[model samples]
Target chain A: MSIPRNWRTRQQRYSLKAEVCNTCNKHIFPPRDVCPHCAAEKQSWTNLSGQGEVFSYTTMYNAPAGFEEYAPYTMALVKLAEGPMVTAQLTDVDAQDVKIGMPVEMVTRKLSQEGEEGQILYGYKFRPMLREAA
Target chain B: MRDVVIIGVGQTRVEEHWGKSLRHMAHDAVMAAMKDAGIETADALYVGNMLSGELGGQEHVGALVADFIGLRGIEAMKVEAACASGAAALRVGMFAVASGIHDVVMVCGVEKMTDAVGDEVTSGLATAADQEYEVSQGISFVGLNALLMRRYMHQFDVKHEHFAGFAVNAHKNGANNPNAMFQSPIKAETYLRASMIADPINLMDSSPVCDGAACVILAPADGYRARAKAHILASAVATDSLAIHDRRDPLTLDAVALSSQKAYAQARITPTDVDLFEVHDAFTIMAALSLEAAGFAPRGRGVCMAVDNEIGIEGRLPISTMGGLKSRGHPVGATGVYQIVEVVAQLTGQAGKNQVQGARIGMAQNIGGSGATVITHILGGV
Candidate 1:
């Protein structure tokens, strides 16, 4: 990602900031300019509590170019408590320990590095909340 | 709208063309198709490509290909919809002829993947997904499908091995296709034990990275009855959220369903009436999802079709009849045109040993991203 592109996306990356559609009472993560469902332009900003459950997950043995360091990493679609799904990595848990309905909380972590001297990209990932562990 | 008939078709085998540049492959396919149509020139040229700019360092493939084919003065441009680039080009060509703006148009789907390294191709493919939210999370395109496969297994109570039927069918049909990248058939055991790229997505489940090109020449049906091979019954495209997570039901391909619905409506035929289907089997999971989304099978029941041996050459609904994206080698953009080309082969009785008996109508569905952009086309005997 370009440095400027990375810098511009900090709001949703850091705080899980989302846009709530005032008309439908639905939340859109990594907020678009307008409501996706109702398209009602009427909107409100909200920072989600980051509570969610895993919808589906995978462990990539062959990661992409810059993400080689994180090969064999686990990723999932977490259904946030706010009623929106977000793509995130499952951290602080073994790939074997991750379950479909596992409850998790969001954490801002380093996603990947552009290069040795490049900026370290950071964004949202999920770790199993303290409620359950094996 | 006037009727648009596919008067000519041409393709290079779906495999690594190490000796051929994109322009070279494009020129070969464009000329072959024009010759098949017995035409001297076309009114326009539309090239379907995705990663030429990033991987080939050439973005304007339409102009590049047109000039290379020695038709420098025609209207030319690239039509891109990620992996669906090929069919997207076909759609543009259809509109050109149907709207009467052009009497004859050429559509080519080309991809030169082997020119770049594996990592570069992988990253370039991910650009098809949502860069801000999806790709930013570092999920590779295969990884995204892996997630879907895992969830599908959990929700439907299916085992990973259940997907073997899809691969087996693709390989079985592909083996008979001389143009397929993988010409050898594989047993179910081979697929069940294939190496995993991402958990739940094994090496056999994913389509290969290769270079190839396919082309079709379209013209109005009024003056082309003698030369026409197949008539375009329908050409429709629909889209959904770029990120799979944004969908109402992640498993449901809304775009696939919508595009297929539109095509079925335009073709005036139900799924049951179709004799064969050329599905985008970039991954086995996608094949099953596409089957369900296109109304071939009920939701969550798609795997049953595979497991029951219902997708073979003579089964209830023949799919991947000409290797498909899996054995056919999905050169991303080129895969779509290959699908249509294969469908034409079937409808015209040109499909050799892999032909579906008395195939009167055929459907081809090409998907981009996870399921964001889907284009469906139906072709019938002229």
Candidate 2:
């Protein structure tokens, strides 16, 4: 990941900002130029509630380069409340504890460091939402 | 358009060729194919490769391979669709010959993955995914498949053990294939005991990352009657969302269904008429998904066909006839060409031990990036 590339997506990484299709009223995460569903060029910016549920997930035993430190971390496809799914790391829960449909909330966290002196990259990661009193 | 036929096919054993360069492996396959076709020069060349730029630090592989094979001045270019590069290139060659623009065209798929050290190759492979949204989150390719497999097992209410048949079947057939990376056979127990790379996707379930090349020569059926081995009855390609999350139903594999359906329609045949299918078995889950999407089995029951031994050579619809990507090894970009070469071998009665009985029609479906780009080809024996 380059410096400019990481810096460019700060809006989405930091605040869970997404684009809503003006025509179909569907939400698109990571923001797209055009709505995929209705092909509507008109869109609106919206911030997500940062709340979702785990759709699917995996604990990567074999991590790629620059991610070895985070080996055996849990990654998940979280279906947001707004309807679009987001792939992010699951925090505040052990790999064994994560389950399908588990409620989660997104939070900003350090993703990785580029190099010894390179910039530190931070992004959204999901953690289990606190349960209500019984 | 005129009918296109495959006249010759060649391949190198799918293995980690430490001594061979990308061009060396490609040249071996190209020469073998040309020799099989009895031609010294081809009118054009299309090379299918994905990691030449990332792993090999070499691009413009089309002209490089052309010069190495002594076909310097011909029309040469590289075609890529992630892992389906080979079949995509073959599609180009098929169009070239069918359009009567070229008399003979050569399509070669080559990849050298072992040269790079450490996780560099893994990173290179990740480039196939949506870099910004998918790989940016630090998930490897296998991780992505693992997520799918987990979701599938949950959605279908299936166990991890049920999917073992796919890997077992691939190894059973690969044991007889001399050019396969893993020539040894594995059993269900082995699959159960194999180490887990990602949850639900054990080591045995995933295809090995190796290096190799495969090639095929295509010419107009009208001009190459004597040398024609099989007629390319259909060539079709379709795509889906690059990010799996973008799809309405991630498990359906709409691209595979669309491409296979298109190919069947073009060939004027249904799935039942095809004798054997060479599907992309990059992972056990993919094999099951492909079978379902291609109409071989009902949804959530593709694994049942393998469990019932229907995917064996002597069974109803044989798949991975030559070890497939699981045991034969998946060289990524080169796998699509390998599928075509294996189908040609079966159609021509050259598949020694893994031959499908009286195979007259065959189908090969190569998928790129978890079913993002699927290229399906149907061939009929002359």
Candidate 3:
């Protein structure tokens, strides 16, 4: 649960991100150091809007002790607008409201803490777009 | 690769083995298969194990099982692919024999999961998924499966009752199995009323983590005999991205579909040709995915098939007559070997009560992680 001191600087993004192979052009989430398709490490970083549709989602009642406060939370596989799918928690909607193809956006929130004082870690979660356009 | 045949199979009942040591339980399971095949010693051994990091605080289980099984001087190694570790061990043993480096090999899968508490077990199993990306966000396996179940329900117009039917059917068959961890039959209505884990998934839809062991002995094709019981027609293994986020569609398991396709091709058989299936049902939603991946039903059609009673014993393809991981008990390492043993039982006409009539051809699908590793095997009567 402890985060490295320079994690924010070294790591690309706290949220899920990936690289699409320049050749085969397949989406690789969490962006691999090398492309598994064409065996090329030559790739670029791209910021995802964190908005996508639910590829699939699940609700879990049985969770770890620290997670009991959020019991029965919905976990979803969100297919990002950029292409690669990301696994994250769905928020601001009931589990029943979350379904395949439902639009969602990412929001940063406190996931869990390791110990005392400044030990809290923040991560991204997806929330369904409930309000319609004006 | 050379032709390989399964000459021996053995398993111990899955439940509270608090009275016995893990190694002792493993030895007993291995010994049964050795005696069944009349094999006194093994040239090489592979053990499928998971969660030793947090469970027993031990690693290197391969040498441990080998030493206790009286194969001290033999080459030994452990194979892991999450829950599919058992099937992965079987694949390694198959390769060991097929490569001509060894004429005979032994594979055993054992898991002592009950050693840890519920929270610890959940955390341990959570490592199977992407730790940094998914788990850090508080996503448990049940939540992941629930999302999949919810999506499948919404997309295919499947009802919560359909899932209950799957659970009820498994329990009915599991009751006939003396070795199943939970042998009592459950009604679909009761299953629906059971405490829910996610909105649609309930406690009944989940597989309990139990402790058990299963073993199998493999030899070259020339070692087969008429009374050998069953022959290994094909064993195919495939792997996909380890992280669930990496998959194109969470509902579709490309690794499983690909491995099953290769296995069926190698065996020259289709899903229709198989008499029964012992596919992994680590979760209730898994049964539906397995059916689709194995080509018994089209994508998104498994729920309908279940509702129509197509996967039942009297239907076109009977599945998990041994209760599956859902009811049979998921011993992690032992699960894949258990599937093989069940197929062997069905093919040899030894499966009583719940057995499919004149069962001859059988298929087993065992997966690791969230479908990162999948191994499919087709076995037939002699």
- Alpha-carbon local distance difference test for all models: 0.91, 0.92, 0.81
On lDDT, the leading prediction is 2
Worst 10 residues of 2 chain B by lDDT: B300-309
TM-score per prediction, in order, is 0.98, 0.98, 0.92
- lDDT per residue for candidate 1 within B1-382, as digits (tens), equals 8899999999988888989999999888888898898999989999999889989898988888888889988999999999999999999999899999999999999999999997888899999999999888989899999989999999999998888889888898889998899999999999988898989999999999999999999999998878889999998999999999999799999999999999999999999998999998999999999999999899998888884358888889999998888898999988899999999999999999988899999999999999999999999986
DockQ winner among the candidates? 1
What is the C-alpha RMSD, rounded to one decimal, of candidate 1? 1.5
lDDT of 2 by residue, B80-124 (tens): 999999999999999899899998999999999999975898788
lDDT of 1 at A13: 92
Candidate 3 lDDT by residue in tens digits, B1-382: 8878888888899887887767987898899999998879989989988876668897988888888877898999888888888888998998888899998788998899888888888888877877777777787777667767877888888887877767877888889899899999898778878888766678888888889999988888875664366888989998887777766577788998999999999999877899998978888888898788778788998776664257677777888888888788888878999999899989888889978998888999998877888999999888
TM-score of the candidate numbered 2?
Answer: 0.98
Better of 1 and 2 by DockQ: 1
RMSD of each: 1.5, 1.3, 2.6
